[model samples]
Target: MVFFKKIVLMSAVLALAGLTGCATKSDKAGYAENVVYHVNDSVVAGAAMNNIKNHLNANPQAKIVLVTHGKGIDFLLEGAMDDKGNPYNVRVQELKAKGVTFDVCNNTLVGRKIDPKTVLPEAVIVPSGVAEVAKLQSQKNFAYVKP
Candidate 1:
């Protein structure tokens, strides 16, 4: 019985040793992989969307957050179309499927007089787009991109 107790204690110690570094390692990995994309220009919206697609294609596991304000919110508006006359829904939905989150600025809606109900179904409205981007960078160490 003493020998069995010793074996069990050694196994427990080994298991604990293996788990000791997991928290820090996992945290570092998440900080490195988290990314934020900011879009405030209506003209470059298409390019920005394409860039996000390429980024996700390259890093399938990367966490992507897109924050939009000002004219940037145009693309998320209902019945919106790009210069090619193509609706933005298909691409937006595709990105959403790949775990990309789209955040619209509530301040923009109020300032621009855009109806909140007109925002794309998948997008979430935050209090402020600029503040959201800053929060992600300062608090979560997310890499910021303006593409």
Candidate 2:
């Protein structure tokens, strides 16, 4: 009878150990990966887009938000293109489909005299791109990336 009780206790301990392992796995999987990408130059936007694509490929559940100002907003405009003449809208749409957000700085638009109508539909205009990046990092616990 004592031997049986010892065996039962051991089994209970093993079961609890298994449950603890599962809990750790669940915690890791449930954690959200939020990232903010800052872009202030159109020339680097293409490389940033590639980095974002690779990031998503590595972690499909990542939440990515891009904030653009100055020349950065050019790529998110209607009929925008890279140096090689590849349309930026297509890649923007592709990333949009994969849950990436594009934000344009309204101040840039006003300073550059760009009409809001000319901005791509996939992008939302924010009051300030720098402020948005600060908010994302400070208030929302997002990691910052400038690639």
Candidate 3:
């Protein structure tokens, strides 16, 4: 009787462990499938862009969009370079090649007295940065991230 009870307890424990392992694997797979990143800082924009690139490489069908406004617009400004002195235009182009879309806010341009033509050619101008963020969240269901 003692040996039979020990076997039953061990079986229950093993069953629970197996279920937990399956749950963890499913979570990881879900994470890789639907991942969105939002970049709102100029200083760390490069790192965020790099992360997007890595995600795209891992999941070729991933959808990626970057929203820049306020001070973040500095990352896509014409002639703006990173800390390494590499032109931001080059980085934007590379990321574009990997299927990343960059959205620029018109409010920032007006507030800063910057001409739209002065920004990267690939950037799309939106009505307002804050509103645009809201629209993306509500309509498109894009994940908001500030790196």
Cα lDDT of model 2 overall? 0.94
Q: What is candidate 3's TM-score against the reference?
A: 0.76
The lDDT for every candidate, in the order shown, is: 0.89, 0.94, 0.79
Each candidate structure's TM-score, on Cα atoms with residue i matched to residue i, is 0.78, 0.80, 0.76
Off by over 4 Å in 3: 1-36
Candidate 1 residue runs with Cα over 4 Å from true position:
1-32
Off by over 4 Å in 2: 1-31
Residue 120's lDDT within candidate 3 is 90
C-alpha lDDT (0 to 100) for residue 30 of candidate 1: 29
Best by TM-score: 2
lDDT of 1 by residue, 1-59 (tens): 99999999999999998898467633443233888999998678789889988877666
Candidates in descending lDDT order: 2, 1, 3
lDDT of 2 by residue, 1-147 (tens): 999999999999999989877764325543469999999999999999999999888777889999999999999998889999999999999999999999999999999999999999999999999999999999999999998
Clashes of 3: 0
lDDT of 3 by residue, 32-87 (tens): 34334555669888898888877776666666778888888898888898998989
Cα displacement (angstroms), candidate 2, residue 124, comes to 0.4
